[model samples]
Target: MLIEHLTMEEFAAGLERTRTVLVPFGSTEEHGSHLPLDTDTMQAIDVGRALARQRPIFIAPPVHYGVCRSTFDHPGTLSISTETLKALTIDIVAALYRQGLRYFILLSGHAGGTHMATLTDAGEVLLQRYPELRIAVVSEYQLAAESGRELIETAGDSHAGEIETSRIMHARPELVKGTAPAEYPAFPKGLLVRDKRRFWPGGVWGDPGKASAEKGARIEALVVRELRTLVEQLEAWQDS
Candidate 1:
């Protein structure tokens, strides 16, 4: 269930049963000219909600803004520094740990380098600080792979590509501009490309023209299935 909608009493009662909280992290950046700026947030929320239905989990409100330096060249893309992102994550995790929540599963929807790197570092620190707490970072692509690779056309190139575009089309069809001319920008070779210094110019790395609602539904199904497996694994570990 969504943590923000619960009353204090309700949340307290929930803590008695389980201390795990799932955080959906996303970015408010350009998802090409076709998809909405909130595409990452929306997809993350959708997956989080689906997972909550089959398990006793609390879904935190999405972190809608994240590091998107590569997309900063595009208008309307909001990005934060790596330091800021790292600090914010540590603070949030520490607060949750104080609140008696021991498990924090971060479901990140952004592919930005700085954001992911900061989260990885923060997760490591939080784990060391609170050994009793369990933390897991769920990558949508990884989850999808566990189910099946056929769900995605181009495995590595996911941004605004067939998989992501289809996902947005399935989750938020109205927000997708189906008429936009699709293009797949190439990445330069031999560069230590971080999120801030990407090779692509237009923020689009794959061809989004193949995106369709049908494909999107398939992708969503795979994500949900894999998430169910992850939750079950967590439950088993807790029981053990």
Candidate 2:
């Protein structure tokens, strides 16, 4: 069940069954010419909802901003610093723990390196404060990447590429403007440039042409299955 829609009594009842909660984290960064800015957020919460249907779990409201890099120069891309993200994450976990939630799944749809690091770091802090609490920081991509490896044709399909395009197509079709041409950035190794958009103008990392709604549906199902496993693992954790 979605925490926002649940009454306080309903939430307390859910807690009695399962103390675990999934908090989706996504970014307000530019996806490409086609996908919506909230692409990551939409995919994340969708997975959370699907998982909830399979089990009695509560899903917290999604955190819609993240530490966006590489695409910072792209239009409509908004970012937060690592410090801010860490602070927000820790605060959220602290609040939830006080509410009797003991298990946390910080599910981020944005797979940026900096963003994921901040989340894991926050999980560490939460653990230090409450050693008995169970927390897992993850991105759906990390759980389901190999599952889609065969389905995707792009060599390094990431960002607003074939896999993402297909997933978005399946999740929110009307929001997709149109398919973007296949493109990749040419950033110099170990050198960060000021005009990042110059290196990656189209903002597409793989061939979106290979994307199809059929493939997207399969991918979403795969993600949900993997996430279910993760939830089970978290609940079964035992401090030795």
Candidate 3:
């Protein structure tokens, strides 16, 4: 259930009984021209809610800002430093840890390289400090990318591509405008860091033209199935 929905007493009781919490790590960033800026936050919350339905887990309020240094060239993108994101994540998780929540499943909808690394570093530090804590940083994009490799029609998805657009279409169709054909820009070899707009001039890395509600539904189903399996494994680990 959503933690905000619970009273103080109910929240305390839930912590006493349930050992796990789902945190949605989202971002307020540019999602091309068609999608909304809060796409990442919306998708992450959707996944968190779905997971909450399958088991007894408290859904925490989502983190709306993320590390988006690459997308700085975009007008609507708001990004935090990697250090800031890492520290924020650690602090939030630490607060929950103090509340006796042992398991934290961070559902990240934004998949920036630096963002993921910061989160990974934060998870490692948290684990080091609290040996009993079990933290899992799961990315919705990564899950879909790995599992839907064959299913996604786009060659590669950098921002508001088919995978993202399709998911948004399925979840919130009103947010999507008409899509257009897109092409990938050639990147400098071994370029460590650069503005995303250089490669994605239109703020889209994948072919949004191929996206459809049916495809989005199929992708969500697959992701939810995989996440369910992960939850089951976590439950078994807790029992053991």
Q: Write the per-residue lDDT of candidate 3 for residues 1-240, one digit (tens) a residue.
A: 788798888989897768888888989998888999999999888877886777788899999999986676788989999889988999999998887888888889998888988999999999889978887888889878877777786777757888999999999999998785675767677785556566767777788888888888888878877876776676566522
Ranking by TM-score: 2, 3, 1
Q: Per-residue CA lDDT of candidate 1, range 164-184, in tens?
A: 788888888888887344456
Q: Rate the local accuracy (lDDT) of all candidates.
A: 0.77, 0.90, 0.84
TM-score of 2: 0.98
How much is 94 displaced in model 3, in angstroms? 0.5
What residue runs in model 1 are displaced by over 4 Å at the alpha carbon?
145-148, 191-201, 235-240
Winner on lDDT between 1 and 3 is 3
Candidate 3 RMSD to the correct structure:
2.1
Candidate 2 or 1, higher TM-score: 2
